[model samples]
Target chain A: MAENLQDKAHELAKALRESDEFQALQALHEEVEEDDVASRMLSNFRKVQLDLQDKQMQGEQPTEEEISQAQKQFEMVQQHDVISRLMEEEQRMSTVIGDMNKIITEPLESLYGTPEDEQNQ
Target chain B: MAENLQDKAHELAKALRESDEFQALQALHEEVEEDDVASRMLSNFRKVQLDLQDKQMQGEQPTEEEISQAQKQFEMVQQHDVISRLMEEEQRMSTVIGDMNKIITEPLESLYGTPEDEQNQ
Candidate 1:
């Protein structure tokens, strides 16, 4: 039973991999990596993100200057056409996955029952 | 664009929810929740489980006695018919969702490229 479900999942992944949206995102991702300028820009943006995450984990808030710096880094990365498209595609993909999560957990939701505000959603 | 993908995801979730396997699991979950004996048994099992997780999070390894105690609690819960059925169903559902996650993450995996050994998987 588990093997069959896993097989089905692999098939689903293959189908999604072939999708235009996924393919486009993949192409853009590769493009970013191939361009030293764009890749460096992305790396810097990621560094800022990780630093903020690390600070939060340590119970420290990022200063206003740090926030502004991160914001500037994000805008700079967005200037690259391939990176811009990749970000948009990532957003679209995230939306679909997020929706799937809501559905996949429906049984749990029904069994435990959601809170009043969530139930309405 | 994002809305369309989200709508499609919702449709896919609806289809999964209507499947017989999902329905059986949901019914079993409700049955266990409604059974006083089974509910209490499962609660004890979960308490043991959380304690082990807490220990691990604190960089502590559970002693042999702790592991043995958790095993006893798990075995006790499995003796309950509804709880057993619910556990089986949860495993099945998790397998499907786990597969979906593999498919959903293909782009990220491609973009970052997994560690050399993990690439084969």
Candidate 2:
């Protein structure tokens, strides 16, 4: 029985790999990697973002200057076509993976129950 | 690029499905389904659980009687070995799936930045 279930999971994974969303994201990722300017900009943007997140987690609010700096960095990244496209593709792939996770956990959800979505009602 | 990412995702999914955790969960799910008494108990438990969740979502707390009834139902199911095993397997599977989700989303996490874990500091 375990073997069968594993087989099914493998099939599902295969299907995801064949999905267009994943393919597009992969392509964009490679493109970003190849462009030094875009790659550096993305790295810098991520660094600023992580720093802000770290501060917040420590119960420290980012200073106004820090927030402004992060915002400026984000805008700069968005201005680049390759960077923006990669970002969009990343979001799409994330959504696809998210949906898959939900499906995989459906049985557990039925058994353990989760919070209901009031807004969906 | 997108194609390549999709391929990687597919591979990851396949690996998850083939994992021992997934297999054990699948076997338990089958066992529960085949046992009439266990199956009924599980179905009833899920129904009551969903109802309680729905009430909460509607901004209504379950009555004391309803809470007691739900608790009793849970206790009854837990007494069954098959059901208990299924529940444990489900938890294990959920954890496996949760980890996969985290890994798949790592790139996005790096790009967009998520809240840092203060406990890890």
Candidate 3:
């Protein structure tokens, strides 16, 4: 189950980030089937580790006003990174869904006809 | 098949919007279970109806300048409406997914352990 995999995934992510294994895996990710469990898991873990690092860095505490200001700056950068990444993902998904919606709805339009006519007829 | 439903869906969308039925259905939609096929379908249809209306409104023929300006305004409003609505939906879905993911990953963390220790130990 994923319960066990969670730790393993984190470990794998950390190892991959620091280790040459990730570089090797990256090549495989491109050439090998993306659907391969190892490839997918590795890819997902890589993103997870990066996000976790950003989150950890963003949560740092500062003692002095200058440090606090620097911490805030760092937090903003991390926050922006996370939010922008998510927004980009959402935009991509929406675009894909929108395209699918268009394709799927095209035939529907022909079958159903325009709304104006539906009321009169 | 969806092929047939597509046409029926458009026709139904028009009817619901024009008829008093939509008002009645709107009331029903609130009381009825959201997961109900009819309610969900109606909800989805309403959205489609509104988007189509906006698109149609924006496409009206304009004279050399004024008409084009009006059309452009209409188009921006329509585009923003559609994009913003979709973005809102995406944000909502992401929030839900993020929550679920946190819940799901909690157990996984316990099972795996920290990445740093995984490689060393």
Best by TM-score: 1
Model 1: per-residue Cα lDDT over B4-114, one tens digit each: 444444555565666666788878877877888888888788778989999987768899999999988888777767888888888887776666676656655776666
Off by over 4 Å in 1: A103-121, B1-24, B33-96, B115-121
Shift of residue A83 alpha carbon in model 1, Å: 2.2
Error of 3 at A84 (Å): 1.3
Q: Candidate 3: deviation at residue A75, Å? A: 12
Give the Cα lDDT of each candidate. 0.73, 0.73, 0.42
**lDDT score, candidate 1, position A21:** 70
Task: Pick out the ten consecutive residues of candidate 2 chain B with the lowest summed lDDT.
Answer: B1-10
State the DockQ of every prediction.
Answer: 0.24, 0.09, 0.03
Model 2, span B47-95: residue lDDT tens? 8999999998766879999999999999998899989888888778766
Q: Write candidate 1's Cα lDDT for A1-121 as tens digits.
A: 3444444445445555666677777888879889999888888888899899999777688999999999998888788788888889888766655655675566557665667755586
TM-score of chain B of 3: 0.29
Candidates 2 and 3 compared: the better one by lDDT is 2
By TM-score: ranked, best first: 1, 2, 3
Clashing pairs in 1: none
The fraction of reference interface contacts (C-alpha pairs within 8 A across chains A and B) present in each candidate is 0.28, 0.00, 0.00
